[model samples]
Target: MIVKPRLPVINRAHPLAKGLVADYPFFERGGTTLRDISGNNNHGTLTSMDPAVKWILTSQGYGLDFDTTDYVTIPDSDILDFGTSPFFVETWIKTTVNNVRQVAVAKADVTGNFIFEMGTYRTLTANEIYCEFYVSGLYPKVLVVDSSFFDGKVHHLVAGHDGTAVRLFIDGVLRGSNVSAYGNIDTASWAIGTYGAYSPPFRGWNGQIAKTRVWKKAPIAREIATLYADPWALYRSRRGIIGKAVAAAGVTYPQLERSFQRGAFRGIKMGVAA
Candidate 1:
């Protein structure tokens, strides 16, 4: 005779649910951080930073007066770990040049292989703002933005190559797409606000930049859009109610929890005096 095994009954107060409830605060903390990165502190705008792992542009080196300030420079030794092929680059840029080349970020052999800046008219014309990436032995690939899309406003720009295709995003929207491969070139160091050539380096951006991030994986279109749509939301959620309340006021996690508990634990007295 075959005996039927009894099924395990799921308890209403299961450990999974309990853990989730207990850990909600931790998840909320991460949201707060995202809010901060997304410019919740200042007016809602993106920013950029130097790309070399340990180097950051100084205050005078990074703001709207980039034309007057000497370009912030980074040494090749600082970026020894960056791989050539699969990577992403994103920055927020404003230009001061009327009709000149302004490089926002670059990493290349000073003389030979370079992924640098290339553009003709700088007067916010169609395809006037763009970046060029040159692999050692391969044809260089260029990513351009139509002036109609980004123009002179503070805009978020992102570019990534994932072995198969190259993708570009403007303010979280996919604007350019192509297929390219950077085989085995070693891009030793990366600089921000200037081109890499010594003789006539593209000196300084004429605008502002903030919140630059580099990820190994090329973020998908949806993910990029989501980030652009509510850059502060992720950071805000991580902070939880207390942090959010402190940052923006009138909203607290405890207040929310109390409201939820009142509804969720209707019959059960949570074992505490009100």
Candidate 2:
């Protein structure tokens, strides 16, 4: 049987719920509105969704697919504006398109020259990963990692800036970092999948995304590692099964139960469920 555990809902028990600015599990569909469970009411609007807001069923419930032409737009709020204090953008992405500059998440002004961005470092084979944020009185630091995450499998990524420096983490491991000062960057609305004023030839992400989140405080490395190692420890969830030993035509509940209890069953367990 292929056991698909029910996705979770986080409350105070969630390790990083403290400064969560927004959380998008992308599990259950909510029309054009991508619900944000952070209780900050920063839900995003699906703009130009190619499949009219497509959500593909996964073991985690649902994952949104983004074509190069669509993106999510979240309104501006003070909580989202880090102002060079401390902040991070994190997400799970799976893709095979490393030949182009793909934007994962970014916040920019109307003219497309402001604040921060976390996206592909550049284009082509083994396209690097990167994060950039502007701090008043200083040029933005373009923190780029030497590797890529476009291997057609799901991977966790994080872009963060502590008060004094910037950091990048991939799959719970620190990929790279750079020393940087801080101050007020511009305050702007958020754009997912694509960035830069949502213009023509957008820096769109052509892939699947699940569980995107942001925190206004710097992430603790130990906490991040803990989340990567034991995601279930932070959230409560139920599990379900399907196929094979799963209940089938004419299979009585008792029979199915016996089968599930005895038959050699396999479960798809993703590493670092966070």
The lDDT, on a scale of 0 to 1, for candidate 1 is 0.44
**Cα-based lDDT at residue 93, candidate 2:** 75
Off by over 4 Å in 2: 1-8, 50-53, 58-61, 123-125, 136-139, 142-148, 183-186, 196-201, 231-234, 237-274
Each model's lDDT: 0.44, 0.66
Q: Write the per-residue lDDT of candidate 1 for residues 77-182, one digit (tens) a residue.
A: 3222345546566565555354566666555556645654422235455445554566556554545646553455556677766667666777788776667665
RMSD (CA, Å), candidate 2 to true, equals 7.8
Cα error, residue 186 of model 2, in Å, equals 4.4
Candidate 2 overall lDDT versus native = 0.66
Q: Tens digits of per-residue lDDT for model 2 on 14-42? A: 55677887887774454677877667878
- Measured by C-alpha RMSD in angstroms, how accurate is candidate 1? 15.8
